[model samples]
Target: MQPLTAYCMRGHRQVEGWLQRGSLSILWSLLEAQRLHALAGDVAEIGVFHGKLFIALALSLTNEERAVAVDLFEMKRAPDFEQEFRSNLEQFSVPMDRVDIRRCASEMIALSAAPEIFGSNVRLFSVDGSHEYAAVIHDLNLARACISQVGIIALDDLFSAWSPGVSEAAIDFLRHPDNRDIVPLAISAAHGPLITGASKLFMVHASQVDFYASELMRMNRQSFKTRASFCGVKTLVFDFTNGVRKRIEFR
Candidate 1:
C-alpha cells in the first residue's frame, strides 16, 4: 500500500466516526493531486463528528494552510465529543496550532463574516453538516462563497437510505437560479465514482467539472464506469459490487 493509504487506513480505523473505508483512498488521492497542482487554500469540514475524515484533510495541508473543524459538539450520544475530537488530533500528531475549532451551527454563520471565522479560499470543503434540506442549502452556499478555483465540495449522505433529505437538499440547492454554474463531478456510491464503500457526492464549479472528472477517470480505480445525470448535470459514475476490500489502491 502507498504510505498515504496506510496512514489513512490506520486513522480511519482508530477514529470514532461514520466514514466509509473506501473514502480514505479517494480523498487522499484527490488532496494529493491538489497539492501537486499547487492548489493552495484552506480545508474545512462542517459537522466534524469526531475528526475521522478531518484528520486526513488536516494532515494533507501545507505549512501555510489551515484546517477548520466546525461542530456543535453537543450530541447526547457523543459524550465528551469535543475532548475526543481534540484527543484524536493529538494522538494522530496533527498540528493543533494550525487547526481552528468552531463550535456553532454551520447555518448560523454567514460567508460575509468568513474572513474572521473561516478565512478565505477554501480549496476543499466537506459538507457533512445538517442533513436537513434548508441547512444543506445554506451550507452549500457558504461553500460556494469560499471555495478556491480548484476546490471540490464533498457532501456526505448523498444517497444514504437514512438521509434522503441530503439528496433532496443537494438537488434543490443546485436547481436554484443562482447556482447554474455548479455541477457534480461524481457520486461516491454503488452507482457512482470512486468505489462502492463511500457515500458522498462530489461537486465542483462548471469550470472544474472536466478537470476532476477527467482526473478520476484517469485514476482507473473503479470496478465499472459510465455517464449518468445527477442533480440535472451529466457526470461519470463508478461503482463496486464486491464487498469492501482489505486493501484499496488509487492511481
Candidate 2:
C-alpha cells in the first residue's frame, strides 16, 4: 500500500474554480500518490472539466508518463464556462509541457480503437464525464479495457447523482460476483467537497475494500454521527464495485 501524499496548501487553491470543483483531481492525486507503485503507463481524465483534474494528474506525474485530458470544453451550460476553467488551470501551479489536453473523449478513445488502448497499458483513469447510467457504463467499459495492471480508476459523483440511473449503474457494477476481484478503499471522507450541506455515503474500490467496507460505512453512516460537529444529512455513492461482475452475468 503506497501513501497518497498529504497536500497542505497555505492559501486556497482554486482548482475547483476552474471546473465545478472537479474533486476527482483530489482522488486521482491520492491514488497516484498512494496505491500505484510500478511505473504507470498513461494517465487520463474522462470528464476533463476545464482540465482541473487533468492538470493535477499531469503535474503529479514525472515527465516520462503521458497525461491526457479529454472533455467537450464546449461550454455545457453556457458558452464561456469552459474558458473560465482553462483560465483557472493556467493560474494554478501545474506543469503544462507534460500534459496533453484533448478536445473530447471520443477523440482520445478513437486513438486505440483499432489495437486496444490497454495494449499500451493505462496507469490512472478518472471519470467525471457524465453521471448518467449509459455514460458511466460506457466509461467503465473504456476504463476497464484500457487500464493496466496495478492501475487505479476513479469515478466522480458515484455517491450522489442528479439521476437515479447513476446509482443504478453503480449498484449493478458492484453486486456483480465477477467483480469480487477488485476491492474498495475507504475514502468517502474525501467526499466532503462535493456534498454542500449533507453527510453522505459513497463507495471506494481497492484490494482491501471488502475488509474496509464495514469501517468505511461506519465513517459515512448516518446513524453513527456522534461527533459534536457532525450533522446527520444526505449521502452519496462512491465505489461499490466489489463483488459485482458475477451479478451482471447472472442477470
Candidate 3:
C-alpha cells in the first residue's frame, strides 16, 4: 500500500464508510477545538468499518495518546473487514502499536472494564457500532463512562432514514436521569439541496457545551447557521456552503 503523511477530507473519502461529507468538517472542527483547549486523552470509535473514520482519529493523536477501535469485523458481507481495517491504517501512516483493536461485539464489552479499556479521558468517542436501539444505548453508556470532562461524543445515524433506531436510542440516553450532565452541542443538518437529513449529533459534558458551541460558530462563520432545542438544550445546526462544499469534494 502507498504511504500517507497527512490526514484530510480528501484522503478520508478514499476509505469506505457511511460518514457524510459534511460530518467530516464537523469532526475536524471538534478535534481541532479539543486541541486548542488543551484537552488530552485517547480517541475511540465503536464501529470501525474498514477504518474510514478511524484512520482520521488515529492520525490526530499526539505524544503517548492512543486510539481504541471496537468492531465485530466478521461481517456477513465482508468477512475480511478486519484485514482491510489494519491495511488502511498502515496506508495512512498510523503505527500499529498506537491502536488497540478489539474484535468483539459492542455488547460483549463489560461496562466495568471501560476504565481499563478506554481510560477515563477519552477526548473524542464515536458511537457507530450498532444502529439498533439497544445496541446504541449500550455503546453510548460505555462512551459516557469513558469520556473526559470536556470530551465530545459523536453519535452517528441520528437522522438517517436507514437507522431510525439510532435516533430513538439517543433520546433514551439524553432522558435518563443519570445522563443529565451530557448535552447536545451540535447537530449536522441539511442546509440546501446538496445536504439532506441530520447525519450526526455531537454531545459534550454540560460544562463544555458553551466552549464547543462558540468555537464551532467561530470556525464555521462562512456556513449557514441556526439553532433548535434538542434534549432540553439549544444545539448549533449548520451546513457547508457551496464554496466550502466544493473544497471537500473528492478529487
Candidate 4:
C-alpha cells in the first residue's frame, strides 16, 4: 500500500470538496480492487459537491462505464456549486459523454425514475446527500436497489457530531430485515484535526466480507501498519502514518 499521497494528492488538490485524502484513497482502492476482480458496473454519488469525489470516480471509470452524479445543483444551498463542479471536471479533462449529471434532490431521484436513469450495475455508491435520517434511509434503499452483486456503498459523515442523524439512520437501515444483506466491510477516516478522523464507512453484501477484507489489506499494505484481532469476529485495522486509521471488521 504505497501512501495514497501520489494517487490521491493531485485530485484532492485539484478538486475543492469535503472528501479527505484518506477516504479518497479507500475509494480508489476499492474501485481498483473491484476492477482487478473483473467486477462490471458503473459508479455514482448522492451528494456530488463540486465534483471532488465525483471527478475521482469519473477518472476511474472505463469507456463503457458511466459516472452518475445526483445533487440539487441550482435549487439548493450552493448556487455556484454546479458551475464549480463543471469547471473542475473540465479542468481535469473528465469525459462529459460518460458523466450523467442529475440536478435534483437525491430523495426525489430515488423515488422517481432512478431505476431507468441508473441501471442496476452500480459498483460504488457514495451516500453524502442530506444527512437527515429519512434522506439517508431513502438513499440507502436506493443504493440497495441499484448496486450490483459485488458493489460497495460508502456512507459519509457517519457518527459525526454535526450530523448525528446519519448514524441513527444508517443503524436503522442496517437493522431492518429487508436490508440484512447489506453489511459494513471497512471504515475510513478524514484528514486533518478540525474534524473527527472517522468519516466514511464502506459496506458490501454479507457474503462478500472475506473478499473485500482481503483485497483491501493486500492493496493497502504499504501505506498502513496492519494488524488482525479476534474479538469474537475477525477485525483488521490499518493505521496510517498520518494518524488516519481504517478498521475492517468481519461482523
Candidate 5:
C-alpha cells in the first residue's frame, strides 16, 4: 500500500487527541466556577483517566472539600487514562490533603457499592469509563444516586458513537417521572449528528416536534468546527394522564 499523505496523518492525530481529552475543560470549568457551600459534599470521578482532570478538580477544591476519585489506575488505549491515576495526581502536584481515590473499577459506581449512602451530598459526578450501553446505564444510575440536590452530572461522549447507549439511556431515564430532577446544564454541539453524521439521535420519551426542531435548528446554526450537543437538559416530566401523545413529529 502507498504511504499516507501528511493531511491524512494530521486528521488522524486530531481525532485521537479528542478521544483522549474526553469532555472539554471549559464545560467542567463553568461547572466548577459555581458558588459552592463549604463542606457541602464530595466531588467524585468514576473514570479518572491519568488523574489530570481529577487533579485539576482536587487542586481547585477547598481543603475541607473531599475529592474522591475511583479508577483502575491502569492506562489503556486512552492515553489520558493513566493506569496509575494516583501517580499522575502526584506528578501534577495535586495536594492529596483532600483527595481520596478509591482506585477501583467502575463497578464501584453503582448503588451496590454503597447502597446506604444513596442520595448523599455528591456535589459533582463525572463518568467516562466504559462506552458500552449496560455500563453507561449503570454509571448513569450510580451518578443519579450520588448527586446532591440541584447537583449537576456531566455525561461525556454525548457525541461519540463509541457509546451510543450513553445518550439513549440518558434520554430514556431522564424522560421518566422519577428522574425529573435531572437537568441538562450545557450541551456541547461539538459531536452531535449534524457535525459527526451520527447514525443515532436519542430523544427522550417526552421529546416533541418543537424540541426536535429546536435541536436541529441549533445544529444548523453552529459553526463548522463546533459540534451540536444536547447542551442542558431540564426534566419536564409531563403527566400521561393528560390526553397527550407519547411522541410528536413536525414537518
Candidate 6:
C-alpha cells in the first residue's frame, strides 16, 4: 500500500468542498494505492457540487486517463454550480483537456449511452448525485456497468440522516440479485452523532477483497483488526476522528 504523504494531505485540505479532510485522505490514499497496483482506468463522479473533489480526481489522472463530471449544474438545487466548478478547476490548474463535464442529472446520464462518453474503463466511480433511493440505485447501476475488474465504486452520505434514502437504496441494491457482482469492500465513516454524520462506502469485486484488505492493512494498522459480517458478507470497518470510516466487505 502507498502511504499518504504530507504533500498529498496538504493538497487534499487545500481543495474546498463538502468532502471532509479524512474522506479526502481516504480518497487520495485509495487512488494512490490503485495506481501502485496498476489498476488503470478512468475516474468519474456523479455529483460535483463545485470542483473540489472533481479536481482531486482530475489530479489523480495520468495523461492517458480521463475524468468525467456529471451533474445538473444549472438546476435549482445548485444554480451557477458549473461556474464555480470551472473556476475551481482552473484555479487548481487541472488540465481542461482531460476532463469531460456532463451537464445533466445522474439519471439522465445513466440512461444515455454513457460508455460512449466516459468509456468502459472506470476504475473509480463516485456516486454523490441524488440522495433519493431510486436515484442512488440508478447511479449504482451505471457505476457497475462501467467499473473495471479491480475498480471501486464509492457511495457517499450512506448513513447521513439528511439522506437516509441513500443508505436504504445502497443496501437494497446490494441485496438484489442483479447486482451480485458488485460487492462491498469497506464503509468509511467517522465517529460522531450518528444521525447528522455521513459515511462513504467503498465497493469492488468479490475476488479483489483479499487484495484490498491486504493493502488496507498495510496502510492503516488500526483498520485491519476491526472486522464484522453483514448478511454473510465479511467487512472491515474503520472509523476516523473526522467522522470518516470505511467498511470493506466481500461476497
lDDT of 1 by residue, 1-251 (tens): 54345567575788877677545555665776786678889999998887888988888778689999999998866655898999988887788889999999997898687656676688889998787888888888888888877888888877776777888988888888898887888765543332223367788889988877666665535533567887778876655455333224454
Model 2, range 78-168, lDDT digits (tens) per residue?
A: 5545676566556654556755666654434643461243334666676667667877766665665666555556655544645556556
Rank order (by TM-score, best first)? 3, 1, 6, 4, 2, 5
Number of the top lDDT candidate: 3
lDDT of 4 by residue, 161-230 (tens): 8889988987788778887788877766445652523568788887887998888876666555444332
* Model 6 segments more than 4 A misplaced: 1-8, 75-78, 110-112, 191-197, 223-225, 242-251
lDDT of 6 by residue, 1-251 (tens): 11224324455455545675555656766776786777889999998877667777787777599999998876575567688888878876777898999988878764457787677899899998888999999998888888889888888887787888998998898889987877887766655554323678888888888888677765654544367675357876766753433333221
lDDT of each: 0.75, 0.47, 0.81, 0.74, 0.48, 0.74
Q: After superposition on all CA atoms, what RMSD does each candidate show versus the true structure?
A: 3.5, 10.3, 4.0, 5.0, 12.8, 4.7
Runs off by more than 4 Å, candidate 4 = 1-7, 74-77, 110-112, 194-198, 222-238, 241-251
Q: How many residue-pair clashes does candidate 5 contain?
A: 15
lDDT of 2 at 77: 64
- TM-score for every candidate vs. truth? 0.88, 0.61, 0.90, 0.85, 0.61, 0.87
Q: What are the per-residue Cα lDDT tens digits for candidate 3 across 46-72?
A: 999988778878877888999999999
Worst 10 residues of 3 by lDDT: 242-251
Comparison by TM-score, 2 against 5, better one: 2
lDDT of 5 by residue, 18-47 (tens): 222112323232233332223255666666
What TM-score should be assigned to candidate 4?
0.85
After superposition, the stretches of candidate 2 with alpha carbons farther than 4 Å from their true spots are 1-12, 17-29, 32-38, 80-82, 105-119, 176-180, 187-251
